[model samples]
Target: MATTFPQHPSTRLLRDLTHSLPMALLRTREAVVQRFRTVLSRHGLTEQQWRILRALDGRDGLEVSLLAEQCRILLPSMTGILKRMESRGLVRRDANQADGRSTLVRLTEASQTLLEQIKPEVVEVYKEIERILGKRKLEQLYALLEELEAGLLEGQS
Candidate 1:
């Protein structure tokens, strides 16, 4: 005999997962990241490392906790990532002068040169996206995403 189960009321009220905002955003993110993945792979950098490099590009240095926050990397994972980056001579860590317990991280000259080399290719990827999306639509997309983020964040506090 076959059995049937009643659906939960909350489940019935839910939107289809594919059409949900978070899922849609994630799907779009995956689609966009795929394009950049090739460029990053060619440079022997992972997406997280690229984020860290960009975060540290213009600054003197940032404390480990602050750098992790800016990079959207968890503190635990940041340790391993920074360890690998330091080993590769991409970044350096110095004791934070303000706080003896904290460390400050900065990109090394080699990583700065690598960023310079990679910038043009990365810009080309942006150009390609702009060309496909059209300038106005791309701007609108950015504005909408920013507004959505701001709105959600406002509710948190």
Candidate 2:
């Protein structure tokens, strides 16, 4: 026979894991990403690949580490992503002239052309989001998100 501790409200550790900020954000992201997945799939691109390509679209050449940072992708993971994209003729990497140890990545002509072709579809998707949220609310949402990010970053220091 074993004795068990009595449960009490004071002893409760968390309200609910489902209500966690990270999980909530992830759920919202998944919802938004689902809406874009079809368009990406039709273009024969993975979400990560698309992000990398979009990050490099207008830029001439960005350092691999900087590109990964801007795209919020891990460096090791980006290496594989770039390899696949390079094989597809969507991107190319060149050694940084200033630093032989560092590499820079840039979009290829094919990807640039593809981006131009897909602009309308992507814009349509953005319009649909605006339609759903309304312009004012969308603007508010962006402001609120930026505020939250700034607040959190500020708190870190």
Query: Which lDDT tens digits does candidate 2 get at residues 24-82?
Result: 99998898898788889999998898888888888988999999998899999999999
Q: Where is model 2 more than 4 Å wrong at Cα?
A: 1-19
Specify the poorest-scoring 10-residue window by lDDT in model 1. Answer: 6-15
lDDT of each: 0.95, 0.90
Cα displacement (angstroms), candidate 2, residue 156, comes to: 1.6
Residue 137 accuracy (lDDT) in model 1: 100
Regions of model 1 farther than 4 Å from truth: none
Q: All candidates: CA RMSD in angstroms?
A: 1.4, 2.6
TM-score of 1: 0.92
